[model samples]
Target: MESLPHQYSVSVNAEKENELETTAPHLPTLLVAPPSQFDGPGDKWSPEELLLAAVANCYVLSFRTVAGIAKLDWLHIECTTDGVLNKVERNMLFTDIVTKVTLIVAEESLRPKAEKLLKKAEQVCLVSNSLLSTKHLEIEVVVGG
Candidate 1:
């Protein structure tokens, strides 16, 4: 297996009168709701954004960890994640999430190593692992040297 099995969990608390002010143990209190386009508060973080953030964040961290293990060094790595939400049947669901990973290396010889690490990162990201098959994920890796 590429990764070992692991378990993680978090607890959230919200008062009856204030659902927006939800807080989790060991985490900051955040206002949760739908996107502003759906009449939700514009100033708060929406669930969709949170989901995509998790994927993007996980990919970057995974890449770093893999690169460290592989002894591959790069100047920088940038990942842009986008989620496509569409109406399916009677519910709105995310049909696809696309992540574009760009890697910059000081030497041309590191390009192949960077690409390999980036692809491994996309495959090993925990957030992407948790997603169902219905949610399609596409990852693109671009290496610059």
Candidate 2:
């Protein structure tokens, strides 16, 4: 929101037989490694997991903004994203990404509005929109305390 073209910077350091150290300005460094699927230790965050996390995080944030602008009252939202990676032609790439969203509202009447906003959030999520994978959204609205 500060400017039209925003920039982000991050640095990653790694040595042979060691986990990667990822850092950004003013943020704590993160240790990441390849996932177990790639024969890694499987105890650290991997690039694939990070990509899915980004998609889920962006969807939640986008929903917060859209719901606020629409003046919709809500209790909480849970977003879960799954990415499918497969061999494409000669390379491995994510072929599909599915985000499942659960929205809690104070009243049943808000269900329709919550569903609408959830879909809108998915449509506007920057991370998912930038991906070349097929994206799917699943919405569930519940009336709760």
Candidate 3:
């Protein structure tokens, strides 16, 4: 890490009856719109989906760093995140978020260590840590050739 505090910037542009264009420095622009639940076209990325994606992405990256430091050999890892939005009082917010992680290793002996590392990753994920919603993780370690 470069420093204790890092900054990020993104810009979003939209016009009446037009799709939203989102861009960040040195990154490709993304098309965003409201999710189907809000009566949007449901054909483009939504802020809600992006939020969940950030959680999943951060978890995977955290796991990679944790596994690398531990010198644990692994083949592949997959993470799927689901978020539940609900109305609380007069506000709307995510009530729960769950991430299902699958990790592949070469030997059965790695299962326990893999499980431990997965949990550790969740503990260290900054995105999930920042969220107020309840978070849950389901982990599966598989021995693969």
Per residue, candidate 2 scores C-alpha lDDT tens digits across 1-145 of 6976888899999999999999999999999999999999999999999999999999999999999999999999999999999999999999999999999999989999999999999889999899998999999999998
Query: What TM-score against the true fold does each predicted structure earn?
Result: 0.81, 0.98, 0.98
Could you arrange the candidates by lDDT from highest to lowest? 3, 2, 1
User: In model 3, which range of ten residues has the least summed lDDT?
Assistant: 1-10
lDDT of 3 by residue, 14-93 (tens): 99987799999999999999999999999999999999999999999999999999999999999999999999999999
Q: How accurate is candidate 3 locally (lDDT)?
A: 0.97
Give the Cα-based TM-score of candidate 3 against the true structure: 0.98
* RMSD from true fold, candidate 1: 3.4
- For all candidates in order, the CA lDDT equals 0.76, 0.95, 0.97
TM-score of 2: 0.98
> 35 in model 3: Cα distance from truth in Å?
0.9
| Clash number for candidate 1 | 0
In terms of lDDT, model 2 sits at 0.95
Positional deviation of residue 74's Cα in model 3 after best superposition, in angstroms = 0.6
Off by over 4 Å in 1: 1-6, 14-19, 133-145
What does the lDDT come to for candidate 1?
A: 0.76
